[model samples]
Target: MNRWKKEFSFILALLIVALLTACGSNGEETNNEQASAETEASEELTIAQINWAENIAVTNMWKVILEDKGYDVTLSLLDMGVTMEALETSELDVSLEIWLPVQDANYLETYEDTINFSESTWFDNAKVGLVVPTYLEDVNSVEDLNEHAELFDGNIVGFDSGAGTMEVTEQLIEDYNLDFELQPSSEPAMLTAIGQAIENEEPIVSPLWSPHSVFSNYDLKFLDDPQNTFGGVEKIHHATRLDFADDYPQISEWFNNWKMDDEEIGELIDYVESAEDPLDGAEKWIDENEELIGEWVK
Candidate 1:
């Protein structure tokens, strides 16, 4: 009977050990499953990027960053109006550059309740109006543009026809009673025209904005808008679909936290313009500025 009792106790101890081991294995499996689920939570994202140089630089920068974090990102180069429409219809995940209180006021007013606008700014001090090369000594301000319209070939070179600046420029011409025609062209075309003018040392005035690398590449001055019709200094904001936060809380959080000042944006635009592949430049920027990016994601 004593031997039998000892044997029974040994078997009972072995069974308890086996049960504990099985429980431990199950607990580890549960943890791993939870981790995997978390890793897969955020879905692929679509970014609606405008073709403006600054917008291109910022959007591509985020593309590289997000892809590195295991998120698939697609960029659609669309005009501002279409971009805004996509955001409103939930067809786009995010719009990285939305100039506010002036430049993009029309769209924002239309979609104010439908989309989400970041409370903060990626960049402030954004002003838009006629811009002239600093070498044009006679041209000082928007009011002065009319006096020297012939010097600029009777042209107020404008940006994308769909751009808010062009819309405001139309108002500006009427408001100031300027005799110059606001030439409707794309941003690239406007820049190229301006560049050619610069090379020839010819005078040119166009709808341009600050926080643009063109100002750095060529000495340019923003013709002062005394009437504030251009709407003073504007804020560059991130506009996302209404459900963006819920669908991609992490990315939405990153967008909300991300902040780039004028100098940073100018540097990015410079690098992108110089690089053969804009994504390569964006990656280089990210690699060099890991600490700043870490703060953004954190």
Candidate 2:
């Protein structure tokens, strides 16, 4: 009887040891999995966003999409010049709208060595030039502006001074030998001026771009550029740091495949403008266009 009892006690001890070993192995695996997940969650990307409507819309859209894919994304609001500089120094990962061959030519020339532009343009029909309300019947071209300088208070309202479009406008003023002054202001301020002018049937001229919600909201016309000061239809591209593609291969691939038509971008801008938070608008658009987004992300 004594031998049997001793044997039973030994078996119980063996079972306890086995159970403890199994528990310890599981705990280690759990810790390892937690660490791996934390590492993935910590991966981050920063995008520079210009305050232009299309840039705001697209930037927010990407922010939401990338976040859903386990990336911590940040958007920095910056002027056109500052954005280019940041991209050159590798401080920014991406810029959604970099108008090429015209508006942003100077920036491209300055940062070409350190910046990389996507081979594919996201928007192809982009244009920039002075614009006026349709009610200004006699003012159909940039040349007409000089004849009716008094109507616009001898001033051509413009976007932020750092905008590439503003740079081209200054050249336009010089090229045409216009007597009017170019007043640099924020986009929202320019829009407000235009809106107020239209409400009272007053004449107002300002530099404007396409793929903007303003075109849909107002009866505006682009003053014909006889000298091609603003250049022909410009293509909007994605600009990134030189090493961004190498660092984020998957995102680069998605960006390369991205393209948006006028109607689509217009809708996105409208949605964004209507929402209290831009991200909410972007999320709503994404939910509605899952199939379209899947093609790029896939």
Candidate 3:
């Protein structure tokens, strides 16, 4: 009887040891899985952005959204040329605003082989051309600019010097042989000029684009482009490095599904401009548009 009891106790001890070993193995596996998931969630992504209002609005929106999704996102403020170069070399992961088939045709052609354009554009019907206030009745078209050159103070207010718009405007001057100068300034500076001119009811002509908040804020009209120097309707697209889609398939899919109407984008830009912090405005817009965002992220 004594021998039998001792044998039973040994068997119980063996069972306890076996159970403890199995539990420890499962805990280690769980820890490893958790660590892997954390690593993936903490992955970093860098996005290139320009100073343009629409670009700023959309870029900030994505930054906030991606960060919320457990990603470490960085916004790199770069010019169009630099942004294209960075994308080509894979130095940047993505750019949220790329006006295609017109405004950024040259860049697209140059980097087409190295970069990946989104399957679809987010905003359509975008346009770029010389714009004037509604009060400027006499100047109704690009052809009219030369006739009323004196009224515009012999200047055509333009955006950044290296911008695609500026390049087209230069060609426009040559194509029309207008007696006016193209003043290259930043977008904000140009907007300030337009605001002051409009307030005083002075005549001013500047290079402007659609899907911009300026159109919502002021009564402006695009001068009829008889030469079509600025090209026809542009589509706003996002682009990524060539391998970006493969590495981040989910993000690539989200970009593919993204779309915004004029009203939605305009409201977002307005919010971004009104807020002291652009990201704050983006966060607010996201909160209000949860359903739309869910469609993208889901």
Provide the TM-score for each candidate, comma-separated: 0.86, 0.86, 0.86
Q: For each candidate, how many residue pairs have backbone atoms clashing (under 3 Å)? A: 0, 0, 0
Q: How far off is residue 140 in model 2, in Å?
A: 0.2
TM-score of 3: 0.86
* lDDT (Cα, 0-100) at 267 in candidate 1: 83
Question: Which pairs of residues clash in candidate 1, taking residues 3 or more apart in a chain or in different chains?
Answer: none
Residue 274 shift from truth in candidate 2, angstroms: 0.4
Predicted candidate 1 versus true structure: per-residue lDDT over 1-298, tens digit per residue: 9999999999999999999999999999999977764664546779988878988999899999898888889999899888888998999889988888888888888899999988877787787778888899888878887777778778888878888888988999998999988888788898999999999998988888888888877988877788988988788889999988876777877887888777788888888888999999898888888998998887
lDDT of the structure predicted as candidate 1: 0.86
Candidate 2 stretches greater than 4 Å from native: 1-41
**Which sections of candidate 1 miss by over 4 Å?**
1-42
RMSD (Cα, Å) of candidate 2?
A: 7.5
Candidates' C-alpha lDDT: 0.86, 0.89, 0.89
Per-residue lDDT tens digits of candidate 2, residues 93-114?
Answer: 8988888889989988888888
